[model samples]
Target: MKQRLEADKMDSAQTVSAFVQTTRDKVSVINNKLQRLLDGYLDQLIDQETYKQEKNKLVSSKKSLEENLLTLERTQTGWIEPFSKWIDQAENLPAVAECGTLLEQKSAAKLLFGSNLQLSASEASGTAQSPWDFLQETKNSFKNSEIFADCAILEPKVGLEPTTCGLRYRCSTR
Candidate 1:
């Protein structure tokens, strides 16, 4: 599984690199087109109407490409680092939940289940499923498994003390 994850990460990195290069190339091409359009207008080779239309198109394309490049660069490893960190800290979740502060526990929950945290009376009722419901489902689905089966038992459901109910209330819906 680790090898597969590493391979997938490498594939994603390569894909992002290719996308960045493609966007750069497209921006360069559009820039060249804009320059040519300017030159044509300056030399009186193309009418003003034609120059305006082509220039507008080139500029729009260039702007879009540049924005895409910026987004790609910014997010290249944004998710990967967090995911890798989560994997690295997977074993520490129990410790974090057991000994860590309320804030740390919440932070770990957010990292594991994303930010769809909700605090309500129903969740504290214990009749309502915990946020780690998916882990339960996974464990149920793979009862004989050696990996996730253990993970299912790693952390007990966060207790519902009225004081800490507010803390346990912040759980991932999904």
Candidate 2:
């Protein structure tokens, strides 16, 4: 039975990995199209600078999508790693038109409360509130916001840096 369960989990992981790969391929194709469009505009084929600017946005969007696909693949494998991988990807992307990120939402909410938000592993052992509760509350906030409703990841606070004790909230108008 244990062997069967392990095999089932492995199969699930394989399925998720395949899905991630397919999603990555789609995002890559879109990114390539955007790149080509941008190149054409730069070469004066498109004529409108605005068109080039819009196409350039695909660079970051494609990158974030790729990162998210990778993160999902990791999650499907039963790993509970920190969300920094996705956050790092977003941070590296160019901020263009409105697009949201899940990591950003959690980080923004964490920032609003405090920066050093950490879910105590020991909480899982007792009747303490689950860490996900905080996230849920933050998600509620995102739904009601007028501007910068998308979530954003924040840089972890170091010694003497202004930080919150719980999840952080960072609202950006840009």
Off by over 4 Å in 2: 79-174
Residue 16 lDDT (model 2) = 85
Candidate 1, residues 15-56: lDDT per residue as tens digits? 999989988988888888888889989999999999988888
Show where candidate 1 strays beyond 4 Å: 1-3, 94-131, 147-174
Residue 84 C-alpha lDDT in model 2: 38
Local distance difference test, per candidate?
A: 0.70, 0.57
**Each prediction's TM-score against the native?**
0.60, 0.39
Clash number for every model?
Answer: 0, 19
